[model samples]
Target: MPRIVSAFLCAAFIALGVTACAEPAHQKHAPQDPPDYKGVPTDMTPPSMLTPSAKPQ
Candidate 1:
């Protein structure tokens, strides 16, 4: 009876281990797009674009 019980417990542990190791492989993460700067320019033109003739003194 003891041997039967030990065998059952061992089988249960083995089944659990097998299931734990059978998880699906991790998926590759997709690269996220950079934030939009659609209406904005990167560089600022000197003397202001608003006042074209205002030269630096």
Candidate 2:
């Protein structure tokens, strides 16, 4: 009985710790309008998804 109770307590503590560490939900910024493309290149990959080109300095 004591072992079961301790195990339950430990499991609960871990769950609480995970919940506390999570990022809080909040209202995100409204989407921005697309920028003018006249001067910009047609290809626009997100910075995070971009890979380094083979060309070196």
Candidate 3:
């Protein structure tokens, strides 16, 4: 029947339109580098040592 054919055509058009309007799900994120604290001193003094009065009252 013509009505059935038209219904199928309309469904197909709607599917194609939805596919065309939809964006690709794939995304590219920028590569991140590992933290590099190579030159920082490992044996730094505590903040309390820098200011003696910073102790608990």
Question: What residue pairs are clashing in model 1?
Answer: none
Worst 10 residues of 3 by lDDT: 31-40
Identify the leading candidate in terms of TM-score: 3
Query: At residue 46, what lDDT does model 2 achieve?
Result: 88
Q: Please give the CA lDDT of all the candidate structures.
A: 0.81, 0.85, 0.84
- The Cα error of candidate 1 at residue 46, in Å, is 38
lDDT of 1 by residue, 1-57 (tens): 999999999999999999899966775786665687456665687655666665799
Ranking by TM-score: 3, 2, 1
* TM-scores of all candidate predictions against the true structure: 0.41, 0.44, 0.46
| Candidate 2 vs candidate 3, lDDT winner | 2
Lowest lDDT sum, 10 consecutive residues, model 1, at 45-54
List per-candidate RMSD values in Å.
11.9, 11.3, 10.8
| Regions more than 4 Å wrong, model 1 | 25-57
Q: After superposition, how far is residue 53 of candidate 3 from its true place, in Å?
A: 31
**Count of backbone clashes, every candidate in sequence:** 0, 0, 0
Instruction: Tell me how candidate 2 scores on lDDT.
Output: 0.85
TM-score of 1: 0.41
Q: Which residue pairs collide in model 3, if any?
A: none
Candidate 2: residue 56 lDDT (0-100): 75
Off by over 4 Å in 2: 28-57
